[model samples]
Target: MIAPRFTAALACGLALAGPASAGTSLVIDAASGAVLSSENAAQPWHPASTTKMMTAYLALKAVREGRIGLETAIPASKLAASQPRVKVYIKAGQEVTLDNALRIMMVKSANDISYVIAEGVGGNVENFVAMMNAEAARLGMRDSHFTNPNGWHDPDQQVSARDLAILAMALMREFPDYSDYWNTGAVQLGKQLLLNTNGLVGRYPGVGGMKTGFVCASGFNVVATATRNGRTLIAVVLGALSGTERTVKAAQLLDDGFSKWGGGYTLASLPSQGGRAQSICGDVRRKGGGVALADDADSSGPIAAQAQDIGGNASDGGRFATAAAPTQFSSSVLTRLPSGKISLGPRAEMTPVPVAFGRTPGSASAPLAANVTGEADSRVARGNAPVIAPSAPVAAGLFGTQTGGLYADRGRTASGNGAIPGSTTAFAPADSASTQPGESSGPMRLQGAVRSGAAAPASLRAGAAAGIKPMPRPAARPLLVKPSPKAEPAKAGAASRKPAQAAAKPQAAKPQARPKTKPDDDA
Candidate 1:
């Protein structure tokens, strides 16, 4: 039922003055499913990584039903390894616990981990998707349909802003105990400190849990839930031009819900405001590089796959806008939000949750930790935990395990920018380059082996002594400089005349006999 206050506002000509030009925005009360305000709430749009919300809901449901356990070990199958970056880079046969996988998928928006979760929880991708669609229908997400586990672009897969609110509400209400999975601000996986893709997580005071998503086709989208004064609200913003816009808009929606707005109607009652956003990549590419190029490699969660131009440039600012620049938000976007200010203050210091590869310790099925030692690579410890390499045998197995696996160090000089492991180059999210001001600059390059200047492990030295050859240095490519034309006029004229004579006569020259050389000449 539509709330009286909302009806009064609309009747008083407070309906949004124009069509929702900035994609869609919907604000709703978490407790009642009553929508406080909305624009284009019923319009179908791509969910992007926000699709992971449904993926998480279903996975948690499986856990509650004993179909899967949080500690269950799942392998990154060949299919998972083949997924593009904004991933944990889990290769086939490598493993992570279900708990850590969920945390990484939510915080880093890792596509491959989503695939592992789908396979672990639902038995396979196809079956998992069927389960997703079934759950959407059950939850009354009438405008939502999922075709893959990660929200990769699929023309056929889409969800309305209202549908997403429904999904978010369902996740929070049904699985309140597991809200940490979505609410977490950062994840420490081995040495990589992966900040949550949703910039609002630590910055927004009441920002509890939810997800952010993007694809050129979808623009920047987020389903953010926050609480203040005991009232929880969910905001869905889709098709924002940049991550800054997405964060600011969602923040404004939540702020309004907490203060001035009262419920007007149930989310289902909102009528469709028809129109679709022009693809950000299409617009940027057409403009010859106006905005940050969307990460063409980002697949929404593992729940949907759409064949679209998913490849493009990285983001403008990293995923979250650094607090250093308050000007990142455009005035055009600021005008749409209730408070015309960018409320994203400095990022809050989050105690990152640790997530490690392979199964949890002590499980009967867990692989035994090998005993070989030296400093483990920085990436072996979860979160900001102390760096500890896996035992030598396990470390050897993990580094460069796949054709393009975790090891990016093949020909990398002491500086981090080295040749990537495989024949194909990896595409990281635009923001992957700079998540925060002081954090690692190159999120895509995971550090393998010892840090620069560190002594090699004794085992490694012994291996070299035992005749194992280290990677050969890549040869420097020779530059070919064309010889300058001779200064002699006679030679120039002769060269030109020869070309003309050859064209006119088509004569074949006799082969010259091989010249004999003295020992000195040969040497």
Candidate 2:
């Protein structure tokens, strides 16, 4: 038996090593694979949805290998359709293009779409899982393993912060062309619009693209990449207490790494440890008399408004009229890692609470239903403008009071104009009045007839006699006059023709007087 003092010390050590040891984080230089900052970087942790990163990697690999093309159609299988919420709800028989599937998987974090992609690329879910592990191992990710294509919680599925960083860097290096898929803030699928689960995409400046994950066993996790001033850094934050904390901590790590980025220790130089944190799952109490909250909030909740706005703008030929390409990687930095054997440690086993359908792994709430489609644009546009009821007919002498009346009848036919007979008001012919008092009325004269300028049109007088209310007139506008250029002195022979020219010019007609009416006639 151990001595009493030794036993007491062992208990203290075990207690100290509980949940506090679970939170692992790391930041690495994307170019050199150098480790800039780390905390329990080697400790095993659940990947949650970040597992989809590996899924994406394999799909891209297939595309590069010509096993599949971006345009290849992927049919949804029964297994794929059976996936829980946060999905596009593709019918099992329905097929989506490989490119679209990848976008949906990344932007929506849909488990169903992941399976669809897996089946399309690897022929089946099991094969896809095998391919994922094979790729992870090939990339020196000994501490990482994948059991499912969509990252549904399984005791065997796990990845360390360091391993995740390696996978992220490998993806950037191996496939630069498809980088936009991961960085997309949102995607449109027919009528449905799915917003990205990765918070840093639009929220953090300089953050290009990445993946976020959460599971009860993993807490909250994110593998984020950011570039600034030619330097790019990848941050792996695992077991964060909350989604906000996960984003904040990842941002903080990137900031610190970028600040001290020049010449750091290589990833191979970092120490490795075995065993997973058992207490990292639920809410953990911290030192400040506050508890570290579990990531109970849905990641999509904060971005719903943004998603709606984007969907609404898609149809208007506005900001999203054209498909947006992903932000490109900054100029490449030449940094190489020293050759060394990557240490592989024993795998740690922890009981994983299976993430249920309709709810994300660690989130307490289900994702908001983002069924936003083209109709959203119409809805939003309708909401923005005030609705106007039909106005009552304008009274007889109430012309020149409404706006836009001057040109209102310009597009209408004579019969369409609701002119009233015997009404005091009428629509002035285009040639009769000048928009501006002293502006040149070029081409205003009719070739033959010389009707009175103020006379109402025959159609207007007929309508008025039939008791149709006269069309409302436009609001009076201030008339502006440009001074006519001083007439040049007439030439010698031109004086005799001046009288004829004056006679040829059309004269402005005088205003016609209205007939006096009895009091009853005024009605």
Candidate 3:
């Protein structure tokens, strides 16, 4: 059952806020939660992928509360695997560690992994969404509701800029230890460089972390956090015309907040506005803006070479690769504030947090969704991961040892000593990275062989894997039977007149010898 407070809040919001606004923006003092600036901040609008910030917060809360562990295993259900693009594309039944799933969900803004996380935390998506609503009400998010894990479009799923600032602050205040998850600019997944969707990370000075969201209805949105001279600020911008616009707008708000100290209304005291964004899907310029929250993780060319570096193929590279310059170019937007400090440019490069599948190497508890074969304990004990295959499951001991790609430098055990054990399995080491303290750092013995950037070679490509599977050939169609035409009734005088005419008809000519070749053959 939904929380009564949440239900009441939803009813009140719907009754009072008739429609959302075209856009909303807010800036606040992170330490005090004091509102610095706001524009339509109380207007409800779609959250888009920025919804993942709340999801990340809940997962961290669960970990802190011991409801789940960082090493807990979560399986990607059919529902998760079937979610739309901007995902890691883990196949149904494939498992990921909670630590890695959160990193992927935050940095990559993966929709599918969000579902996997929802299941891991709340046992399923429905329960998790309920938890989200309850949490929102408890946090005093007066104009917010969540219907899905990844913030996919739903008319009912809405959040105000003020509420977004509140949520961002909650994540910071409650889980300061897990701050690395949101701030990291990228995470190397085997051969792929998964950069954060928020382009301000490495580019804008003092920009620490946060998340970005986008869809046609929501335009583009971001909840960004930054620190400078002992001052930290949270900026929320919603429903911009493009990705760059949203980033720039957030930067401008942050700059203004920094330039001018706060004397404005607090979040709770802000006036409530009734409206929603006018649908922008029909705008050709908005559609063609070509900015998306989802990055092309599988594209070849320069990104492929970068993946090779993360896979330990680059001469100057090591087990893990840091976030490098963006592969594509973006226009820089200058700040309009008096301080002239923060500006929106290309995504800044920084060292990424490492993530992998399976439990942390030395953890005591078994994965939440361990193998059904009752071999999870033995397999994890021996450092063997489940191998992913396109056709069918393979026998145990066939998957190779995980590489010392990017990982936390936990003291290596014999199995963790970067040596492959005696086995007939053919597997490649996955991506590795240096991790923040308390994150999963030991190398994973992932099941299935994944090349750089490619999760399951055949099953995890973004556009290719998320499409409808091929159908079996339809049965041969039955031949149609044409009914015989009914005989026409004879005219009154025809029966008598036909006998003489038929008798007098000239004899039919004799058939000539058939030609050797068919008549139409030459023609």
Candidate 4:
């Protein structure tokens, strides 16, 4: 028989271990910091690129304090250039505007770009990292620390789901004016276009701007926000298996939180372990443990593969294996909630400011219209293709309808400008040759000839009209003559008369050889 005191202590130990060992997830009301649901909220995990949030926060703070303007030039340094992959590849001494650098860092998740901004704003990466930690502690993110601005993997650079939630909330609440920065789906840097990595940006309905991060050690993580019926909520998901899985799980969490939202306990009421998250990097097959429930039941069982689907139907329990079950409440929980809706936010309407390089710091330039056409000429001269700015409104119909996988328009030639011919917005030279059948003597004329089944030119036109002269057209190619078919071979028995005919035809005499000529003396 076991002692009553021992059994009671054992039960308490199991209960405490439940929440401590569960995977990290949390949802809270952005306005009141109310915790709607959470699991393993305080377990420390690698922040990955999500560290950009802190970097961005500090940058925005600096902007508010008048320390740096949006147009301030931030030069890339050797330290900034040495960062690992997922970088903008900006060389040392080159500079990017603070505004453009932030967009590139967030949208592209560029490691080097983060460093550029870090050095520019924080005076050095170490100083910036120090500022990040100081701010983290000030915001009550006790379980978080920063070793780098870009969130590149370092054992010391870490954050908990709760800490991330706090940072995200502070970002939204503190910098309402810059909400569109993270909200934007894509940005254009000269000819290079970068799309946001946050899959929930355009896919999940009402989902607003946030960030996403990933590394082998951290798996995939996201701090996502959504608004519906004038109510806004934020969800943090960590240690997901794939990009799709992270997004789907985050969406499901938002769906569950919103469905059950009724102003519950505030963020301060939720428990915190104040410890680092258990490293699952060594256990590749233990993905199921990340989303486990904080209860004594075997909720850590492997989630079904179907739960990975973003549009998958939920089970009768009102939960997909990928989504954490709602924490028990005094009221009965609804078995089913409305299906996840498409994010109807204004993400489509938001446009990133065009990033220009080589401009003097703080000098103003005319706003380039999205429909502007002549910019490609200079880019082409420099051997860099210009991209046609997208002008169409966001596509409608369903989630992820904006565009196919991150579209990149390297650059276009004068003739190949990405616009309809004859339009004012068309990017072509005044002397651009018409390809019409009756017209001739222009760059496109050869193309017209080929399309019309007429004689084609040896080469197409080259060079823009305003710069280098076009190469001369090569001489037209001569047509080849076809050989006639050979006559049938003579039959074996019928060929005997050919010898007599040959002797009669070859009776001509040979001429005598001429004397060899000597070198002329004075001809």
Candidate 5:
């Protein structure tokens, strides 16, 4: 059968993004290749920024095919720098290192940087994009296309939630270093430090690096990843309305995926009612691979590990290539991984409960859905993990805030404080230096004069003094917390009373002892 096409991808995507459907979400075990939880997994829709996954895929392939190197420099032409929003603002003639440019584009989601790199690697924007389409076809990205490197918007640029999940896995497998940037919390470019748009990077448990995309037509789209035990899973949520909504939705999907113990069925149980279950190539039980999960070893309720009679179909993207693909600029050169730190394990396992299969197709309990697709093969293995089912609703809201206005206000506050309280705290979580004005939040205390040219009280002052004027002195935290009014009298008395006051007139002048007068010095 012919593979799905780009135009059909957009039409099919729009058709799938119904109000009732909200498009489908999938949480697949990257290791076992098992479907943990699926909601409308077949729907199609505009890919938004997640389309960059295809872009990254092709770029990595070029690296694999001998075309570009991470250190290769690309010039920003008038056309390349014209795009706006989330940019490092490279001027037309300025040269940006390919490695740094991608760090800006992937970590910061810079539209202009993408164009610059596309041209830098392919010699021109259009030709680089042609490479993107060519690579997508080669990878069997049936429901995808690229008119622009930065997913600004076009009926022509489209991908399905399922295809996106597959694409994400491919990128992770192909370009480990480049993919690691997706998890980067922020980027540093001269005067400006751009933060990652993916909220799941530091907030939700197990979630790592991935990309975020938005457009009026696509709402919000995110290709999210998480790791627990040794297993890593990818979730694709398309057409979400807000960043918070996207993370929460993605987290919910991850929870469902990690919740399964993937307990093994007896060899007989695996065969199913009639024929041998279509074998996925990399299921953990397969020859050399196994799925990884954290915590539960034996089982988590009834795992959705039941086998199916698929017609032996497998993902077109091949198994994890044992060796890293060759780089474009040179075979010997390998791009160094970007440095960034962030992670929180998936939430502690909830009480073990039965997984509901009513809404799910091919669940452990329900007969595999009638509409089940073809047979598949994968290399996956068993690992301990907490159980959460996707069919259930996720109760928590996502982190990150609205764009501009309150968002900018929050960023100013969170960065100042050092810790972004995320969506939960009263005062946005801030770094300690933010608590003291004119100081940074993270680490590395300023050796210079702090506020009033005085020393910072504690060593906690770590971060930038960028926006603050002269900075403020670190005030005692007690002052910020309301002090009791009644204690004022006691505190004042203690300050005023002299050390001599505590001594009586010696009850009398004992032997008329002469006492030395101590000088009163406030300085």
Candidate 6:
């Protein structure tokens, strides 16, 4: 099988990660299928980049069915190599086996790999996507539909965290052989050390395998799995702040869940919490971070493939207001019900945010998600990708009117110049002022927030016109005069920026040193 020299035949890369605009977050115990904790678990949302979870699910099904084997090699054709954004640097016509494809696709969350796998498996992405939908239907994911392989911006594609949890659980049981792929820490693909994006894989106790996702529409989301005392638990935390928050929240949830359930876990206990009466769906709706852009905006970070609560107050001081911020999201059975209606979780004085997800576009400058890792990433793990509904929302009997995989609250009102939530209030906008493309009317600018320090074209944030007070840019470092470029190191793999042969120009460019291979459909 054709395997990259750097990446072990085991697992591969990271994917985007972010949440919706509003404040939202959720946690669930996969084995029991319970909604342990949540903010707006039922609200419609943009599935962002988490859509890759579904893509991986479909591909894994093929792997398990013997249609494609781990050792089976497929080439990264020009078409696949041409995919934009996230990718593994595979040259055109360079053969990559099914196993390595999954590794790179999962760990790196390479869009290019997705395109190649789609074509190799179904002759084309359109056809492979058909298989994805078929599998979704078979899995009883009636509320879901897939429009792309990598979970980029496609309003038509979506999924809810609940449904995502279902898929995560299914993968755990249906394909035990592939489970090890998720737990991979990093792949030593030649000189490059491709690290796993999931923070807890090797850092946290009991954390096993899983995935994370993000995009422009969705926020940071992770299907976090952990095992403690022989009791395995998969905690899916959708739409968080940054990479660190996603894993930390998942770990906290697992800690709480294992502390209480360990051997006593059950489906009935899925809707666990710290101290509140959660609804059938969950507790407080799960959410990402909030950005104080120029306008009244919600979570404006990079939304993953599958991926809010909107909050704010503008009248506190002149036109300046504040927004609701996200809290530490975690999963655990209710410790003691707070004395209240429990419509929302208890509001303590934490970091207040205007939107649910991260800082709005003007302030949200980091990458919301990382790439996928392992032989197969999860489908629902696609991070936040903004979802703009059509004038006529798509409807069907199986999914119900106003029903889709995930949901976003498009009706939340906001105030101008809001800070973090708590003291914020909604106010009307000045009629003469118009919104800029990247800036929201909320306190934060909603136009250009992205994780990984990447960004959308400036054109996307052009709609808003008011000069948004941009987030404090990172401190500028004095540029030191660079030394003249030296001879490049010779050990880098095909993934490096410099040419592979430039560093170690072997006598005449030839494949004499190429590693021998035996098909590893089972790797």
lDDT of 3 by residue, 374-398 (tens): 4434322233333322311111111
- Each candidate's lDDT (Cα)? 0.51, 0.48, 0.51, 0.50, 0.41, 0.39
Ranking by lDDT: 3, 1, 4, 2, 5, 6
lDDT of 6 by residue, 1-523 (tens): 1123312211111001122343244454433333344443333344544566677666665543334444444556687777765555556765555545665566546677777777656657788788888766655454467887876656666665545665675555434335434544443333343444565543444455567665534455677766543344556665454444455455555555444322221222122111111121111122222321110011222211111221111111101112222332233211222331111121111111100111122222222111212233331223443332221111111112211121110111111101111111111121225432222132111111122233222221111111211111122111111122352322212222112112322221111221221111000
Model 5 residue 324 CA deviation in Å:
41
Cα lDDT for residue 285, candidate 5: 18
TM-score of each: 0.58, 0.52, 0.58, 0.56, 0.49, 0.49
For 234-286, candidate 1 gives per-residue lDDT tens digits of 88888765566567667666665555333333444443333442344554233
- Between candidates 4 and 5, the lDDT winner: 4
Q: What is the TM-score (0 to 1) of candidate 3? A: 0.58
For candidate 1, give the lDDT: 0.51
In order, what is each prediction's RMSD in angstroms?
23.4, 33.8, 26.5, 27.8, 28.9, 24.1
Worst 10 residues of 6 by lDDT: 349-358
Q: For residues 375-482, write the lDDT of model 5, one tens digit per residue.
A: 321111112222312211000101112111100111111112111212211112234543323211231211211233232232211111111111121121111111
**The 10-residue segment with the lowest total lDDT in model 5:** 391-400
Model 1 TM-score on a 0 to 1 scale = 0.58
C-alpha lDDT (0 to 100) for residue 488 of candidate 1: 31
Model 6 — TM-score against the truth? 0.49
Clash pairs of candidate 2? 191-373, 296-364, 420-463, 420-464, 420-468, 421-463, 421-464, 421-465, 422-464
Stretches of model 2 off by over 4 angstroms after superposition: 1-22, 262-264, 276-279, 284-523
